[model samples]
Target: MTGLAAASLAVSIAVAGAGVPAQAAETRRAPATATAQVFAVDWVSLGIAVAGYLFSGGGGGGGLQAAIAEIKAAIEQSKTEIIAQIDAIAAAEVEACLEAHTIEFLNIDFMDEYTLRAWAQNATSCATQASAFAGAVQSPQAVDKIGFVIGPIFAIVLAARAQAGFINGTDLVLQSQIRAYEAVVTKLTPTDCQLIVTSEGSAFYEKWWRCTAYNGDVGRSSPCFGRNCLPNRAMAETQATLNTSRPVANGALPRLRAALP
Candidate 1:
């Protein structure tokens, strides 16, 4: 018999044994002898056997349904747990990216007071010129107000754009994790699921460590060793090579936006 058929038969027999009602008559029967064959068969024994078969069939069906329900519940729980972990990871990744970008900005002299003031003045001059050009087509006072707003707004936009780049990088890493997690879920095997989760965790740690190492290389190679020095220069060249090697995906922005709260 097939495995499923055998399992069904076993369940039926077990249920029959458990639910059998007591009977007064000797229900056990043997193959009839030529003399005994002439006598009539017992109708009561036939009824009992039919009843047992029906009861066993019903119990087996119930058992199969219970098994199915259990499997479904397990899958649902696993999905929920995996998604929760992904969300937490995504949040942490965003925070890390912001922190990294902040540090990168701090390292750049343009983020310092003197350089910042110079940039602000340059941005203000550009805004004033653009406004004057637009004034020919709109209200002069309105254009002047717009220019006034643009000075500070432009600085804010620059800072925001810098932050966005880091956030975008974080989104790429999160997308990788999501894809890996989905692959595990699709396989729906215990071992594959465990491996995927473990691999994702390892990847996260490795990326963070690599970023930290890059920062350290930047620090060691700065000022005393001078610009375009060994390690920092090499690191920049290596990153540029990696960027070229990877395929660019334009749709990543929308994916990252959806992940946001």
Candidate 2:
């Protein structure tokens, strides 16, 4: 028994001994003192009860150990459950990011401006969700083992966004080049030239030849040709985006797989 328990037991025994003698003296003093004797007996009983409690586990013995062990086990189980749930959530997010954005971004080189723009919007939405998830996991306090899993996923989303920006930029450039070409062609074409109805349609062929020659010259000097071509630049941008995001996606895959069941 602990020192406190031993001390309590000794005090209870002393109280019991003193109470018995007092009860005997009180009974001898007066018949009316029977109540007093009973009160003394009650005190003795109370002391015995307190002593019994102390001797058992009230003083922090085996019962306390058992209770503490049970509490610890419950806490550990709760922690494990919480961690598993977080791991599952992280795995799902990583997979979604990969499927909706990362894989599609890899095919950017093959997508047209319209297709690329559509994909960009989708990637942007995915990135928004990824950013929110990343913030939730890190804020208030960072969760253990989550940063490793989420960091690469977030990076790949950002890369997708960057690739999306390139798509928009290239589209603008292509549009501008088209407008410039149309303006030049409108200025060069003879506005008042009338086709003459002739034998074997010679006047019609002559007009067609002149227009074709002018258009060919414009085409050779247009932004659509050579290294300044928007299509080539767009392709280069797409490849660059793929290069930047590939490592992040590759690195995240292993971590995401590990986090899953």
Candidate 3:
């Protein structure tokens, strides 16, 4: 009977100790569950932050690309507009110069028919003088005999007409060069235009002075001043102006091309 009682008492103590341990385990598990939930929330927050950062970076990059494209387009448009303006100016200048030169050439007076006939007759006289001198073998100088008989009349009419033609042609070509320079200046900025005008004007005046000086010599008589002198002079002047203006024109072409789109 005592053994039975003792066993019952021990069983009660064991039951009480098991209840305390079970309560302690419940308390630990509750804290562990709360800690796990907090960790999950922290992970979710970190993922959200990273996603937001990526979205923002992409948005910024796209905006930057769009802005750059707009700027480039604007620059291209500006270049095209500028180039067109310049070309129009060039065309007008060319036309004006051409008209001036054409008028000058057309208005030139030629030697009259009577004068031409008289000059022809002088050539015949020269032939006769040459034949007579050749036959004499005492050889009267052909030049001296011809000059004594016919050179003066030919010189007065033919030479005067020739000289007039030369001066007229030179003026025509110079006018053309002026027109070309004007056209180039038209494309430039007002400031650039002023520079071009000054440069071209200087070149024109220099060539004009030289041409006048050259033509002043009695020996330099021809429609183009004994050669292609006037045309050559005008060409030189045009080239000089081009040398100054071409870089600016060429630099603008790429921008103009880009702007077309």
User: Residue 159: error of model 2 in Å?
Assistant: 4.0
Model 2, 1-261: lDDT tens digits are: 243222322211111222122122211221122122221211112122222333343444553333323322322323333233234444486435534453454465578878876776665555445434444442211221232223322333323333334323322322222232222222333222222222333332211111122112211111232222232232222222221111222323333232222
Worst 10-residue lDDT window for candidate 3 reads 10-19
- Clash pairs, candidate 3, are 86-187
Better of 1 and 2 by TM-score: 2
Candidate 3, residues 62-108: lDDT per residue as tens digits? 43233223322322323332223223322343323322322222222
Instruction: Give the number of colliding residue pairs in candidate 1.
Output: 0
Instruction: Please report, in order, the local distance difference test score of every candidate based on alpha carbons.
Output: 0.25, 0.31, 0.25
Q: Would you estimate the TM-scores of all the predictions?
A: 0.15, 0.25, 0.14
Q: Which parts of model 2 have CA positions greater than 4 angstroms off?
A: 1-94, 137-146, 149-151, 166-261
lDDT, residue 103, model 1: 31
What TM-score should be assigned to candidate 3? 0.14
- Each prediction's total of clashing residue pairs, residues at least 3 apart in sequence or on different chains, is 0, 0, 1
Best lDDT among the predictions, by candidate number: 2
